[model samples]
Target: MLTVKRLDIADARILIKGASEKANEIGVPMCIAITDESGNLIAFERMDGGKVSSAFVAQDKAFTAAAARKATHEYNAANVPGNLAFGIHTEVGGKLSTVGGGLPVVVDGDVVGGIGLSSGTPQQDMDCAQAGIDYFLQNRG
Candidate 1:
């Protein structure tokens, strides 16, 4: 038998809160998404003024992070033409993302979930996603 850790709704909300704060700090309204270890969404938020197109993108980012257990940017870095992973973005019914905003949420060396943000530049989105993880680590009690 195998045991797995997953994120609850409360954990999902914390991720969204931290990511949103960073987005606000950076002056970008964002779409934030949180997913359990299997890439199932737990919570999502679209701030006022956030781009509508970013909604699904954020979810896809979160799914990639959680299911792949890696930051989406790492995939982006290795997705160059002629690379074996080049077509990964088209996998999983086009749900996998090679963008910079998705990060796995690790707890005690185990990935418990994922966080993803969109509506800003890829770098900005990555920053907010990282901020969300930092905040969750500090406040996971």
Candidate 2:
């Protein structure tokens, strides 16, 4: 049987800090969320100027990536055009947003969690998420 590991709150904190630092450097307020592999919320933060609406969206994005075990954009891209997984966003309790800023957090080639960022342009959001992922990978205990 295959086993899946879960992310602890300490790791979640690390991800949030990394993402926040990147957002601060870019002068963009952000909402960052982390979720365990099973799509449960692990941690979240919303900077002072981040849109309140982004909180839920960020959480959903993180959950979707973690549950799907793929970057949301990849899922969207591969599912288009006659693919049954197409419009999966509508089936996953409407929790999946196939946007460009959410990424799955992998460990040992297995997804263990996910990170999501919002409140900037798509590129900026992706950059902030990448920073978080890098931090997690480098600092893993």
Candidate 3:
């Protein structure tokens, strides 16, 4: 048997706020999601004026990051053209995305959750997600 830390709502809010701050700094509206290790959504936010379609994308991104335990772009880079996993986006019932906005949340060297953001360019999404992940890492034991 094993025990692992779970993200509480307060922490989820912290992540959301951190991500929102970054998005505001970049002047990008965002849809953000947080999920637990089992790929279940814990909290989510769609900022005012964010893309209407980005909510689902953000949720799937968080799910993929938590279940896959890697930054989403890492999958994209490793499974590049001519690589073995080039068409991985077609896998996992087409739910896995190798986009820039997804990141696993690690605490004490264990992936406990993930954060995802959408409604911005890939770089903007990554920047916002990274901000939330950094805050989680800094505040967790």
Give the top-scoring candidate (TM-score): 1
Q: How much does candidate 2 score in TM-score?
A: 0.90
Q: What TM-score does model 1 achieve against the real structure?
A: 0.98
lDDT of 1: 0.94
> Residue pairs in steric clash, candidate 1?
none
Which of the predicted structures, 1 or 3, would earn the higher lDDT when compared with the native?
Answer: 1
TM values, all candidates:
0.98, 0.90, 0.93
Q: Cα deviation in Å at residue 79, candidate 1?
A: 0.2
| Clash total of candidate 1 | 0
Greater lDDT among 1 and 2 belongs to: 1
Best by lDDT: 1
> 39-124, model 2: which lDDT tens digit per residue?
88999999999988789878877988898888877876866879877777776778887876789998888889999898888778
Ordered from best to worst lDDT, the candidate numbers read 1, 3, 2
Q: What tens digits encode model 1's per-residue C-alpha lDDT throughout 50-113? A: 9999999999999999999999999999899999888888999999999999999999999999
Whichever of 1 and 3 has more TM-score, that candidate is: 1
lDDT of 2 at 27: 99
Candidate 2 CA-lDDT value: 0.87
